[model samples]
Target chain A: MIPAAFEYTRARSLADALKAAGTRGTKVIAGGQSLVPLLRFRLAQPSVVVDIGHLPQLQGIKRAKQGTVIGAATTYRDLLDSKLLHNTHPIIAETTAGIGDRQVRNRGTIGGGLAHADPASDMPAVVLALDAVLTLQSRRGKRSVPARKFFKGPFATAMKKDELLTEILLPFLPQGAGTAYESFEQAASGYALVGVAAVVAVSGGAVTHAAVGITGLADTPFFAASAAKLIGRTPNKEILRAAAAAAVEGVSANEDIHASAEYRLHLARVAVRKALTTAAGRAG
Target chain B: MTQTITLNVNGQALKAQAEPRTLLVHMLRDELNLTGTQVGCDTSQCGACTVLLDGRAVKSCSVLAVQAEGHKITTIEGLARDGTLHPVQQAFWEKHGLQCGFCTPGFVMTTVELLRDNPDPTEDEIRHALEGNVCRCTGYQNIVAAVRSAASALRGSRRPGAAVSGG
Candidate 1:
C-alpha cells in the first residue's frame, strides 16, 4: 500500500525546519524508516511531510564535558562506525548495531527513533539507563527533557506537537562502570518483544549504584526502580533474581500478533535477569 | 496531490515531476528509466527497493520522491560506472550471490554500504547487518563471500593502491 498523499517541504536548516513544522498537521521526516512505513500502513496520515534529512545541524556525534551528545539525526550506522563512541559508550554503539540491519540502521536516526517513541525501540531503554537527556526544539524555544521523564505512554512522548527532537545528551558512565543491553526481538517487525538495559557502577566489589531499565513489557520504558533499590548495597544471586522479578512487577505487556501479554512479561523477567548478570559480570 | 522534485541519481542530476505521493522507486523506474532497483514486496519488509540515498542504503519504496529532494541517490543502474561494474556488483557476479537476481541490486547496494562502514566484518556481523536486505537465493552462502571480497577490493582501492583479496 502507498502512503497517503502529502505536501513536501524540504527544510534547509533548523530555522526552516521549525517554520515548516509549526505544529498542526506537520510531520517531521528525518529517517523515514518508521514514519514512512507507518504511513504506508495507514497508521499515520499527515498533511505536510517536513523533510529534515538535509539539515546539517541535526547530524553527527559530539563530545561534551559531561558526556557525549549524539545528534538526534545521527544514524545507527554512524554509531556503528564511530570509533569514539565505540571506545567510551560501547554499549550504546553495540546495542545500536543490533537495531535492524545495514540499510535500516543507515536510514533510521536516534532522534527520530526516540521521537517516534516505539516502545520496543533499542535506544530508549539504553538512553534511560544512561540518564540521557533529550533536547526538544520548536518555534517557541528549546527545552531539555530527562530520559526518565520523556515517555508518557506507548508510542507517546513528552514532546509537544511543535517541538522537534534535536539532540540526545548522554551522560558518561563513571569510570569502572559497566553497561549492557539484551533484547528478545520479534523476527517479523524487528521490534523487541522484551528488552532490558542495565548500567552498574562497582566500587570495591560493592555495588555503588545501578540503573535497570526495561522496555517492551510496559506501556512506557520503565526504570525498574524497585530492582534498582535492591542493588545499592550488595547484590547476590537471590537479590538479582528477586530484582528481575520486581522489574516486571505491574508491567503491562503489549499483546498482539507477535507475542501474548503474559509471554512478554515472562520475557521481561528473563531479559532483566540476564541483563543484570551481564552488567554485573562486565563490571567485575 | 503531486509535486516536482530534482534528484541526483548516480552523479547525474535529473528533474522529475512526480506526485508527492509517488514513491522513489516509481520515479527511478518510470521517470528516469533506472529500473534496476526492484520492488519485491512493495512492503518495506523486503529490501528489493534498496538504493543509496546519499551514500547510505534505504528502501526506495519507503521514501517519496519529494522526500529525497536535493539529495544524492545511487540505484542499481549506477552500479556500473562507465561500463565497468562496481566492486560490489563484480563480487556478487563472481561469487554467485544471486539466483533469481530479483534481490541482487538491493543486496549489492546494502553490502556496498556495509563494507564502506566496516572493511572487514565477521560472518555473524555480516549476517546481522544484512538482516534488512533479504535474498531467498544462495541461502546467503555466496552473499557473505561477495561482501568479504568486496571489502578487500574497497580497502585496496582506498589505501594508495594495494593487492586484491583472495588473490
Candidate 2:
C-alpha cells in the first residue's frame, strides 16, 4: 500500500512551511497519522507534501490570560503528559487519552485531527463543547474561526487549501463549571459510535450555564440546542431525561454496519444524559 | 523521485535513498535489511510494525521513512547486547508468551516501552497497553504473564542504590 509519488519538502521554519503550502496541489503533513492513511488509500493525491511536524513554532501548550493555547502540531502524547492541561482542562486530556492506542497517540496531532474533520473523531466534539477558537494562518495573514463553525461535513472543514491551522485557543471554563465526555466506541477502530460532551455550570442549586456537543450521529459534529433547556432550572433526573430525548429531535442520524440509525439515535440520547449527569455532578 | 536521507537505526547512522511514500517499516526492512520488524495488517491496525522512535513506540508503517531521518529508531534487532537476550525477550521465552511467534517482535517492543514507563503494571494495565498489538494465536494469557515477569526482572535489574517502591 504505497502512496503515489510526490515531492516532499521538510519546512525549515514557519515561513518556509507557509511558502511551500501556498503552491497548488500542496498538502501540509503534520504527525501524518491521518494523511498517510489517506495517501495510501489513494483518497488524497497531492503533488507536493510539506512536512511541518517538526516545526518548533507549532509545538507547545501555553497558558494565556483567556485560556490555554495549544500549538497545532502538538501530539496527543504531549497533551496526556501535560500537568497544566490536567489541572485546567482535564476533559481534553481524558478525551485525547482514548483517541487511539498508545502508538497512535504518539503521532496524532490535534490540528490534523480537527482539520481532517472526521465526524467520528473525538476532539471535534470536545473542542466544540469547550468553545475552542481555531486560528488559521496563511501567507496573507491569520484569522480565527470558532469551533462551532469549523466543521462543514464529514472529512471537511472551513480551512482553505493554503491556510494552516496554527493554534487552538480553548477558553477557560467559567467558575463552578465542570465538563465530561462520554462515548460508545466501535470495538475495532475505537472510533465513537455516538460520542457526547457536556459542560455544565451550577449556581445556587440550579443550572446556570450548559453546553452539549455531539458526534458520530451525523455528517458533522454539532451542539445540541436542547441543552439550553437545562439552564435556569434544577437538573433533576426527570429533567435530564427529557432534555436527552430531544437531543436528536430534528437531526437525521448517520447509519452504517456498526449501528443502525435508530440505534445510533438511542445511543446519542443515552450518551447525552450520562455526560450531562457526570458534568453536573462535578460542577463546583 | 528518491531522496537520500540518513536514519539512526539501532544506534547506527545509515544513509539510504527512499521515495516520499516509503514507509518506515519498508525502509528498515527492505533498505536496511533489518527484518526483525514485521509488517502485519499494513493498515496500521496491527502493531506488528511497532518500533521505538526516540524511545517511544510508534507504528512504523504509518510513519514515512523521510520523517524518521533525524530521529533515533530502536527496532527489535537493537534489543540484545553481547548475544544476551534482553530481559523482556528472556521473559517472553521463559513464559511461553508466543505460539506462532509472528507477533512477538511487536509485542516485545511494546512491552519494552510499557515496562520502561511503568516498571510494575497490573494485569489490566498490561492488557490495556497491549490493545494495539493483536495476537491471532490467542496467546494473550502467556503474553500477560511474560509482561509481568519482565516487569519484575527489570525492576530487580535497576541500580542497587535505587529506591525500590513497588513490585
In model 1, how many backbone clashes occur?
Answer: 0
- Candidate 2's DockQ is 0.80
In model 2, the runs with Cα more than 4 Å from the true position are B161-167
Q: Give the winner by TM-score.
A: 2
Locate the minimum summed-lDDT window of 10 residues in model 2 chain B.
Answer: B158-167
Q: Which residue window of length 10 is worst by lDDT in model 1 chain A?
A: A227-236
lDDT of 1 by residue, A49-114 (tens): 888875789988878998898888888878888887987788887688778777788778888888
What local lDDT does model 2 show for residue A48? 89
lDDT of 2 by residue, A202-244 (tens): 9998999888999999989998877888899898898888888
Q: Can you tell me which runs of candidate 1 are displaced by over 4 Å?
A: B81-84, B149-167
lDDT of 2 by residue, B1-167 (tens): 89998878888888888998899899999999999999998578889999999988899988999999888999999998778888899999999999888889999999998898998999998998898898998569999999999999888878698643221
